[model samples]
Target: MLFRVDPASPVPLGDQIAACVRGAVAEGTAGPGDRLPPARELAGSLGVNMHTVLRGYQKLREEGLIELRRGRGAAVAGGASPGRARLARAARQVAEEGRALGMADEAILGLVRAALAAKGPPPLPGPGDGRP
Candidate 1:
């Protein structure tokens, strides 16, 4: 897995690390039972402090995406599905807020449909593709 840190971004280093790991897991770049690099090693690679890496790992652990062992370091937890339920709840809350702001459901759903259509197709090669 590739880890990158951008100092110019407003997000904190640890939060950025955590976000990357979460995205990797959701996108299947990091799979269940995969072991993460040690905090110090990853910190060195990213040019950040070890504590920053540790904090990122701790956040993942709190989200049930990783398990920390005493001597073995951090490993990916099996079945670490993204929080879809939480996202749905958040979306509902956002819709409520939008209503309070005088936005219509039709406008919101149209925006969502346009966003989905703009994403194009999935890139993963499937059966019967020309490229070999």
Candidate 2:
């Protein structure tokens, strides 16, 4: 799998790592039962701290996307079917919400595609949205 990090991005390093792993899983670059490189090794390769890699793995684990074992590192968990279904559900939810807000189908899809292209989670709404 190809992973790249942009030191200048506003997104956290760990999130960038997580996104790369997620992309790999979605694209079939990494298959079920495939063991990822050890966190330390991946950190070294990416020129980031070990904790960053571990954080990424932890996020994947939390999402039920990967299994982490002591000394064994991380491995892809479950079949791709589950992951695909989850993604589909998420996409459907987003589209439904966008339509409910009166956004056109094309606009909704464009936003989805843009978010996917971004490095991490979608940006939070600004002060006008009531966030601190």
For model 2, name the residue pairs that clash. none
Clashes of each: 0, 0
Q: What is the C-alpha lDDT of each candidate?
A: 0.78, 0.78
RMSD of each: 12.9, 12.0
- In Å, residue 77's CA in model 1 sits off its true spot by 0.6
Worst-scoring 10-residue span by lDDT in model 2: 80-89
Per lDDT, the best of the predicted structures is: 2
Q: Give candidate 2's error at residue 113 in angstroms.
A: 23
lDDT per residue for candidate 2 within 31-132, as digits (tens), equals 789888898999999999999999988977876778899977789887544466368446646866898899998899889776765655757656586532
For residues 28-128, write the lDDT of model 1, one tens digit per residue. 77877889999999998889999999998997787778889999999878857556324433454666677878889988777666566558585555568
Q: Roughly what TM-score does model 1 have, to 2 decimal places?
A: 0.63
Instruction: Estimate the TM-score of every prediction.
Output: 0.63, 0.63
- Model 1 spans > 4 angstroms off: 82-132
Worst 10 residues of 1 by lDDT: 83-92
